[model samples]
Target: MLGDIWNATLKGMNDLAGSVGEGAREKSLALIEDWLEIFPQLAEYGLEITSFSMGLAISPSLNVELLGKHEDWSDEAIAKRLADHKGEHSITTVLSTIRTAYRLQKKTQAPLRDPLILKIVVRISPEVRVVLGQPILDD
Candidate 1:
């Protein structure tokens, strides 16, 4: 079961690459690689480091818009869309991509007030009302 899940994750990443484009795909793959290197613990959950791919439906990052932005839709509609999409997109992949983007932007941008800086700050914020009462880090 674990092997199958890992294999699927790799294939999914590859699929996502094809969906985007060569340039974006390669960048996404690199970010996933970095994530794999740091999150050795994910192996226990079936995400093997050796199984990264570019074909997955994985988003390149976690900006809310990247995940799915529908300005006209109500919150309930958005929630439903997310639930439907969750089966196709892995939250782990999104989180990794977002973190990678943040790191890159931090290094490339001058000063701390660049536009990308704000985006990164908002992207990783766990302060949204949904989890406000929960602990930031779970051990």
Candidate 2:
């Protein structure tokens, strides 16, 4: 089940890269690689990326939603711990790299562009279940 989910996620990411255009495909793939590298670190904090969306407009941006589960901890506590740990780990650096890659892509792409934005939203949940055959949860 886990392997299937992983494979689907990779396919989705590859589709996103292809949709972004040839010029930016390499950068998009790199960003995906960077994200994969940080997954284990995030798991240590009981956090997992639930979903992500990318938009191109005046500002090319990627929005990532993370769901965290810490049964004994309050949402605020989880958020605080993740924030502190993020600074101590490669999260901040990787985010910066992603933003830089988007910015570079923006400069080379056609049409007008603004600064790239990487928005991350973290939410605390008591439990997270990966429903079989579902790529993403509705709730």
Candidate 3:
């Protein structure tokens, strides 16, 4: 899934990079290098994001009525989870943040359409954090 997006992002970057200056090309290559370095770190949290998205889809306050339509509830695990009754609370909590003030606005759209790679840990989970933006901005 991420490999597809990574390839597409790189293709777009390379295709659009042709008319740019030497400095710009060098910067883009560096950014891509950084992205290549960081993308592998997100593999550990695979199902969490999907579960999070599913929670968003079922949220009544979020106005997403196409819940079952979006996710195939026919799966044994999903069916069992829904049957359990207690699973909904946990799923919702995992995806939501409570604001202290009366500022909770209606969420008309889903939080993530495509996964954005913002940061990744290099070589180890609790090790160095790197950003894709770092390379482009580096002098």
Candidate 4:
């Protein structure tokens, strides 16, 4: 599963280079590589790191975006979407990149003031949420 994520993410990063400048492209790739290095810890929390990859171009650091897809906003939505959906436009590359922009805010740590990056706790699967001790609620 993680391998798929890594491959997909790597391809996504490579493809991203064409849409951005040379320096911005390299920064984006480095940031994704950094995130992938810590993927186990991030994955343990049950939230698939999402949209903030491009934010890395502007600032080499970022919290992931849980609202990478509108329906991915909550675990319930994630579960439902997983169970019944197929071929979502945003889900095409394991996540969406359109939501990312150079102007997006950034900080030293996660759970930023940005609404898109919020909801990660609830966005996680129920079991992982329990382990993480985050009381599940509507996202």
Candidate 5:
């Protein structure tokens, strides 16, 4: 069940990218790669990115879903862990990195703009049976 949901979500993201022009698609894929570069840091907080999607519109945004390494870890636990290390939650850390990257990209003649919306979801377990009507991380 979980796999189906994830697969569908990924497919939707792919479709969105395909619908956009080639330039936007390449930029979005590149942004995803840049975001992946932070895997090590995320691992430190017992978090691993499960899936992600980038949306380019009036305001560019990146939506990320993360799963905890341990089944017992809750969203608060992850947030606390990150706060202890970086004085902020996981979302803040990720957003800061993303915004910085966007700024650098813009400086290099990229079409990305500032104030990018970043949405992060931290799931305690991968055994979720439903994608809807369930409590999300940080809820």
Candidate 6:
């Protein structure tokens, strides 16, 4: 039973990952960059940015509801550490933050429509810490 659950969970994660593809990733980044481009002077402020992988891993919708709180991290290094740790408290904290951001950005609308990626992001996100608002690279 335990093994079966694990397998199911992994499959779900894959499904979620597949939905938020390269196109969505690029589109999301472009949207954010356009939003931020207005403030060229604020470039030094290290706005924590998150990738599609991390966002999907932590399916922000469930996380926000679970934690009931959110806070931003200062840097990618700290975000990565929070994501890697397995402690319940740490996971909850990270998930809460991601969920809050997810809601704030209205990211759920699209992902929810795609069951596969939505499943992956929601199931795997508790273990991932995502920084928001990173600069998008020109492709």
**TM, every model:** 0.21, 0.31, 0.24, 0.23, 0.32, 0.20
Q: Write the per-residue lDDT of candidate 4 for residues 7-72, one digit (tens) a residue.
A: 999999987865566666566555455444434433443445554433333424343444222322
lDDT of 2: 0.47
- Per-residue lDDT over 1-139 for candidate 2, one digit per residue giving the tens place of the 0 to 100 score: 9999999999999987767665464454444444556667655655566677665532234456555432423445445655665754346553344434435545777443332222352221111222212234355
lDDT top scorer: 5
Q: Arrange candidates by TM-score, descending.
A: 5, 2, 3, 4, 1, 6
Model 4: which ten-residue window has the lowest total lDDT? 122-131
Residues 1-139 of candidate 1 have per-residue lDDT tens digits of 9999999999999888776775664566565554434234323323223222233533343222111111223345335545554643344343345445445545876333312211111211221111112234732
- List, residue by residue over 40-124, the lDDT tens digit for candidate 5: 7666655555667656652344667655423323445545554655743443565344435444554778443222223352222
Going through the candidates in order, what is the number of backbone clashes in each? Answer: 12, 0, 0, 0, 0, 15
Candidate that beats the other on TM-score, 5 or 6, i.e. the better one: 5
Which RMSD values do the candidates have, in order?
A: 19.1, 18.9, 20.4, 18.4, 18.5, 19.0
Better of 1 and 3 by TM-score: 3
Q: Which parts of model 5 have CA positions greater than 4 angstroms off?
A: 1-39, 70-139
| Candidate 5 Cα deviation (angstroms), residue 19 | 25
Consecutive 10-residue window with the lowest summed lDDT within model 6:
112-121
Per-model CA lDDT versus the true structure: 0.38, 0.47, 0.29, 0.37, 0.49, 0.38
RMSD of 6: 19.0
Candidate 3: residue 89 lDDT (0-100): 39
**TM-score for model 3?**
0.24
Better of 3 and 5 by lDDT: 5
Instruction: Show pairs that collide, candidate 4.
Output: none
Off by over 4 Å in 1: 1-20, 41-55, 58-139
Report the error of model 5 at residue 77, Å.
Answer: 6.9
